[model samples]
Target: MITGGTTVNGTGVFCACYIRQSRKKANKSEASPEDQRDKTKGYSDNEGHHFVDFYEDIGKSGYDPDAERKGFDRMMNDARAGRINMIVVHYASRFSRQNVNIVLMQVLELFQLGVRIVSVNEGEFTSNNVMDLMNIIMRFEAGHNESRNKSIAVRGTFEKARERGGWLGGLAPFGFEAYKAFVDGVEIQLLRPRKDESKVIKWCWETIKRHKDDTIKQGQRHPGSLAGLVHQMHVDKVPTRGARVGGAWKDALWEVTTLNRILRDPRIAGYMAEPYGNGKKAAYRIQRNADGTPKKYGYDPILEPAEWWELQAWLDSRGRGRGLTRGESLLSALRNPEDEPVLNCACDKSMCAYYGGGTSPSPLYRCNFRNVPGHNGNNTMVQHHLDEYVARRIFARISTAEEDGDTAGFLLEATKRFARTQEAPSNARERAQLVTERHEAAQHLKECEEDYKSVKDKGPATRRAVLEEMDAAETRLKTLDDALKALAAADAPALPIQQWINSEEGNGDPMGEGSWWATATLASKRRFVTLFVDRIVVYKSAMRGNRWVQYDASKRVSITFAGEGETEEASEAA
Candidate 1:
């Protein structure tokens, strides 16, 4: 009896057939988008309504917000524009499984716009009659409840499987393959190390540990450890896990980000990470027991706990003060000196590498803020000259300390200062407490959910209280998770000077030709500089010199070593 705008046929009502399939169907028995479309079309035909258009949202959740459901949004827009006066869906659930109140409001809006919604399984949804209104409310509430219960059940199943050391369904982590086997007469998926991939992982750990000692020839380039691994994998034609492309499986190229993820993933250490919910950021939070030790799976681990922690520590150390820099340069760490205050121009702004065209075409360290009005100073210094000056100063200081028999004290104080500036040493007791708090919060969340389900029909007030408790518990869990992640990322004790000395042995003197400095990679030299030097203040050139004359760096630069109160002028002679 509802009137509609005239269509091409000009007589009967124009109906838009809407179909939705939320998630892939597990089996053919479950209704698909095609099935929903057919049912809606048949009902439209039976009612003598013209099927003007079809709108389908395949593999889109009905509970998603209206903006996320593209087909549904288009259908509503068309109905509002009088292109169609009714939306015909296979069932009310196909239209929406949003909150009951939200769904009711949408339906009311449609009715006010002179449009109506018809569900083939249920009848025309109308607010005119009390019974019809009650039926509409019950239909949407039922759909919402069904989706919520399904989500809870699925999470519980995954958690139980995880606790039992079973691999939840997904592509296995790199360096491992998933296999199904019967455990006590029940088949479950499990992960096992893949031989070739495992070898690559082992090589990565070994290479990264010795990365600091890697040397580059005069013209050859070294991309440090993480990027170097990617290049080596490509050169060796190392195959990554195959992915399906256009119906055929293809191998992906090794990437720096992928390598980083593999190195950071706890699965390599024989533990599964907790599954995070949608919209939550993922972190490698290993499932742990009440005693705060990682829970093990039924497979061999590629890296021991100590090795994994060592790798993490190395990564944390590298991540700090990392930024874009021109090809292998000693002052790379000083490029962004906001945090360390190590390298500064006369104008107080951090100096950056500037490659410009002039009579002196080589790269120069120039103040980034020099071009601003009223900032007048000789802010540029030849890169090589400054680098040589700083390196000589460091070598002289080390040599002096060794002669004075104060090397041990100097190294100890320097290590402590570096550790303090870089990152706080992770507290074991604090980490354990955070892990325990997360466990308790998770348990409390489960209890709240169960209470909500049990008392849903009791009263609105009771349901709200339970939901509030669930939210609070979830917030607490998130906080604890973030704290645990911070603790994991905190730098391990800075590498001892003796370790550096040992690694650099058999090279030569610390300052002479063929020495550690001559062969050390740019990354290694940067680390060395950051560990020993606290700040370098550059002043305007004090002496007039021509291009033919050797610039006197001693008069223009001051070097401040870590744990030292006074800044020392650069030595006149190396």
Candidate 2:
């Protein structure tokens, strides 16, 4: 059980703080996020308890602290490892508001296990006191009260912004900037156009419509109504409202967020939020699952139905049956004759047969799902002709750009290359060593637990030995696991990487090195391309003598082929 004291008699009491601020900071100011964080650091110093880490979700709205997964994960990790003997925060809501009962249970348990909590702005929570219990309850109540205040403040901000023009706390469209109204008024938005970006944006919608019209004329397929209107912002990639970093353009995909910003603005659409904020009706998500899953399509439609439909029609058209994009083309189907083998079939378990001229005509790699009987996926016979393509396309450019100054082509190619790679691990070895150490410490936690039982049952200086031994073991184990997991993942196959290198069509000019090609290794190059262009739909027939072959009419094989009809190209001559 926990004891009320200034200090605990334990050496490994891990200390952490959760830092948050309600105000948004777009620039450097005394009241900005950085300043607020510094304040917490100073406060921790004054309290005499050394906090080894902090969870900073500054500028992240306070009403829904649970949405900050990073903060939650760190807090949970602290609890599970028994490292945290204390959780410090400016206020209780700084941790969580919505799930008070659950959050309190977690924090209170940490106190019982010799951990303590202190809200620097609120008060210290000691398990023995009735005051601490009251403080927790009051803090939780304050969190909800604060939420109510924030909603009112937001409504007022929107009301004022709509009437007088200001920046409300909402995101802006892709090609716009949210500026403060007047010199120091509410936030407002201004149209920030890209270099011919507006024209291109509209043209993207037009291009889709044209493609759909052609399909309809061919009687090949029926197109959706909103075929041409592509959303500037969508679910997959909500545009970040800031300057582009590195060489990336546009920041994120055009999505509903972008569209909504455009439609809601009275500045661009010739009205403001003031009218709507004071209006009787309000909009909320129509369909939320009892368990919280949201239905995809949600619209509060400020604009007329006709205008919204036009936008939808534009989007539906662009997504019309796009035959596996150039990047997604398959190897057996790819037509370049100037490549070598890179990918091996999981079917054969090796590249010995398909490569090295064992087969007269190149054989595509087939999955052994059916043949092997128990594989991750069904026995999908996707083919791969990866002898040369991977080397030339995916990893080749990294070589050329590094050796020679071919920056333009390199970036474009690199984007396609990078799209295939997986997101990096949350805790890389170099980072968060404590997290790994704690996890390791946890593995051996059972050992300490046994020793702890021995001290209680067998009775006795032995306490130090048990606790110290368990702590050391757990820390070491975590470090080792972290090191192993940090090793870069083996390059895997991608649908686009294969198609890009294998096809004669899009394999941009020779990988130019001023003197010689040196950036990438033969193995790296091969692995890179094949990983992207994973599966190829192979349509083949038994060949006789390499001169000609009779057509097999029975087998109409179409794995991923999206075109209306298949044609016999000279490249695929049997």
Give Cα-based local distance difference scores for all models: 0.69, 0.43
TM-score per prediction, in order, is 0.65, 0.36
Checking candidate 1 for backbone clashes, the offending pairs are none
Query: Which residue runs does candidate 1 get wrong by more than 4 Å?
Result: 1-11, 24-29, 64-67, 126-130, 164-169, 179-190, 209-212, 217-225, 244-251, 274-283, 286-298, 313-384, 391-544, 547-550, 565-574
Query: At residue 560, what lDDT does model 1 achieve?
Result: 69
Model 2: residues with Cα > 4 Å off, grouped in runs: 1-14, 22-33, 59-62, 152-198, 201-574
Per-residue CA lDDT of model 2 for 1-574, tens digit only, reads 1222334346744567677665455453224545546665667677665656676665666566445556657666656666566777766777665546666776677767776777767777888888887788778777768786767887886666544444344654433445543535545543333333344344444444454323132222332222123333332233344424323454544444444434333232122222222333421211222222222212222332333334443342232122211222233212111122222233322122122223434433433234342233322222332333333433464434445553444344344345335435542333334433343244346545755876865534577767666666666666666654443223322334333333333334433342112244433443444433333232233233233753332231222111112322223311
Clash count, candidate 1: 0
The alpha-carbon deviation from the true structure for residue 523 of candidate 1, after best TM-score superposition, in angstroms, is: 12
Name the 10 consecutive residues with the lowest summed lDDT in model 1: 332-341
lDDT for model 2, on a 0 to 1 scale?
0.43
User: Model 1, 1-574: lDDT tens per residue?
Assistant: 2234543335558888998887755355247777787888888888888778788787788875653788888888877777787888888898899899888878888877767778888998765777877888899999999988887987886666666777886887778888987775556788889887889899999877665344443334445567777898788887777642212437567787778878877788776665443432444566655433457776778986556765665565454233334444578444221245477665555666666745567777777564443245346788898898888777666655656664555555565545545553356556545755565466567756877889979988888877877787788778888886666556646544343443244553565555667777777678678767878877766555587986778887887676564677644311
